[model samples]
Target chain A: MKNIDILVDNATCLRGDNLIFDNISFNLSNGEILFIMGPNGCGKTTLIRSLCGIQHLENGCIKINNVNINNPECNFLENLVYIGHNDSLSENLTTYENLEYLNKFDLSNKDEFISNPNKFLKFFDISKYKNYLVSELSQGNKKKVALSRLLFTNKKIWVLDEPLSFLDEDSKNNLIKLFLDHITNGGLIVTSTHIDFSNYFEKSKYLNMKGININE
Target chain B: MNISKIANLKYFYKHTKNVSKILSFITFSLFIVGIFWGLYIAPKDYLQGDSYRIIYVHVPAAWLSLQVYIVMAVTGFIALVWKIKIMEIISIQSASIGAYFTLIALVTGMIWGKPTWGTYWVWDARLTSELILLFLYIGIIVIYSSFTDKRQGAKIAALLAIVGLINIPIIHYSVEWWNTLHQGPTVTKFEKPSAHITMLMPLLYMLLVFNLYFVTVLIKRVRLGIFQREKNTKWMENYLND
Candidate 1:
């Protein structure tokens, strides 16, 4: 696998006349995890969105592998896997169907989940709900279906927001293991959460949005 | 020019504020003149008489209904291709305005048809295609509103708008394509208009009025959309304070 490097330089975001965050900067390479910690409404989601090229920055730019995301020639999205606060799944579609639709965006041959979705669904403990409509599933199960995309997608970078909120303890543990395994294979993950992950990954980097501080 | 520069909501909001006022003034003036000329000053139609004055309203509305859909389709294309937020907002905002124009065209056509054709309704090619156009607009509006994620809704709606564009040419050429109770051509023809100069003049004037009126209303609606979508942005706060 090739190296993955992300650069967020002097980022600033504003809401109305309010300054959400200012002069934030960070860098990450393959196998490193970026944990954005913040209180509610502290611009954690905004920062995550900006990094994923879903939101524009007022002053700075985010680059993946030295190419600025705003550049039209940049094919950043092809290598990106994003799961926002919303699961972004169709409620009317079954769990398996939703995964099938999302997998079409995966350019690489990551068909292990596509061929046998039960592998990832069982890992998340949602295999029984595979044929059920997404609307019938609980919030955690919906989230699990969304998270299962990570296992099937060959994209190197995963940007997630509040991914642990609706998951139970066992699901969360399973997800953390998946995260660890992904980084071990040179994949990079950027996540926003209020929970402390020090107990899970001691080497994980932290960016606290409350004070625009970076703790390496 | 960079598309992002032109599509900037802050600049567009302010620019439309100054421009819409002038457009509104011109629209009001033209409506008054067109009404007087078509209803009173213009010589009566030798064949149909004053009942034909409804043409002043019907023709302009019918022309604008198609024009607005074209605008919606173009904006939808830009939104889908370039993914400009302003274009998405413009595409969705045009739906209701275009729908209203289509409804006006249909109702006024019915009122005109009662005296001319001896019936208020027919499933003629021109009329049927127009009704379909209105349904397309309604479909876009409903599909857009159904999604909780507004961006996703806009994308799906944009795709529908582009696909629905095929109906425009069908609507435009329907009269030529099929035999129908609808009249063939008027001021839109390539040759000289069949009507006399005085009678034709007001119809043209009313067409201009409708065009300007669409822009006037579109500017207002798009400005409102920008405000609603950017309600929490710094530019909006600055704009509100000013």
Candidate 2:
């Protein structure tokens, strides 16, 4: 099978009576990082959701590996992971239990994460809270737990919405390093963030929501 | 297991917690009174004698059991079509209660049959169909609990319930339709009830009691199911936190 490339062509999304964004397009290849930077309410979340096939695109074609992404037969869904703005963790479960439960559905290697869960938890600085109920954790810690799920999955395309919103400075740097490591291993990382990541990714493209322009 | 932790009737109603307890208590109380009146107070049947007393509990139980299934099936349909989380929860709750009542009816019928027909069990049409209903209830509950995706499980269970409903009418009408050894409809059709007004009064009262009892248990189970499904929701957090 040929490796896939994701292309969003002339996409437009609407929220209520207002047009959130129009004619948004981009192409992402393997071993590349595309940083989506936009101010609040600029439809960065909307664009990511549309690309992940969770939201309806008013007018656009998302093509992956030369096949229409929206086509049910393409099976693009199996190759992508989209973590939304909301923390989808079940609060009743502990961090370890949550990760173990999610790992069952992951298409990636399970043994790596299963054997060294604390390594990832420490990387996110949540090692002490590993056994704590998610309901008891702070918002930033909860976001870290949610992000850990991404590390457990082996999906090629990672679509994240505001992943750095609640992380501390050190945690943010660790996440940037993790993203860089993911792309270095021939995976694609598409994330929406307001924080400046220019020092980390040299070739990352930036999109400004104010004028609706794509930057390189 | 703590009785105090089980949640009392007033507190349960206030918090909408464990509503089934109160309902079950009221229904069971009515059942006790009805049983005493039907078996001991009412005169022995002119033809079947004391054996006819079984009709009071057996017939009502059988009727309510089928009624509960229909209610469950309807809720299942709503859950599947509308994607209503509450409907799915209620459907699951009703399934267990309905199954229990169906089992009670089957057992009581067998007991009454031992002395009258000289057999505790038979492969008669009504009995067989009721057995099938019990299996359908089990199938629904099992399917719902097995899947991780609550919505998907509810949809599948709802479809199964609807399909199983086809057997309900067959269970009810098997005696009249197929000329089976089992008796035809007694309390349902008023044209010719086998018992007089004195016997019928307590039976009707017991049926009403059971109806209220089913509603009470249903409310409690629905509440528990809702708590399980909505535990992750923000609303649940607010409710619990407060």
Using DockQ as the measure, the top candidate is 1
B-chain TM-score, every candidate? 0.87, 0.78
Q: How large is the interface RMSD of each prediction? A: 7.0, 16.7
Q: What clash pairs does model 1 have?
A: A16-B232, A16-B233, A16-B234
Query: Per model, how many backbone clashes are there?
Result: 3, 0
lDDT of 1 at A33: 90
- For model 1, what is the alpha-carbon lDDT of residue A63? 88
Task: Estimate, for each residue in A88-115, the C-alpha lDDT of model 2 and write its tens digit.
Answer: 7888999888777777776867888888
Candidate 1: true interface contacts recovered:
0.00
**Top-lDDT candidate index:** 1
Off by over 4 Å in 1: A9-25, A39-61, A69-186, A199-202, A209-211, B1-8, B15-18, B83-86, B145-156, B170-193, B229-242
Clashes of 1: 3
Q: DockQ of every model listed? A: 0.13, 0.03
Runs in model 2 lying further than 4 Å from the true structure: A1-216, B1-15, B18-25, B170-193, B232-242
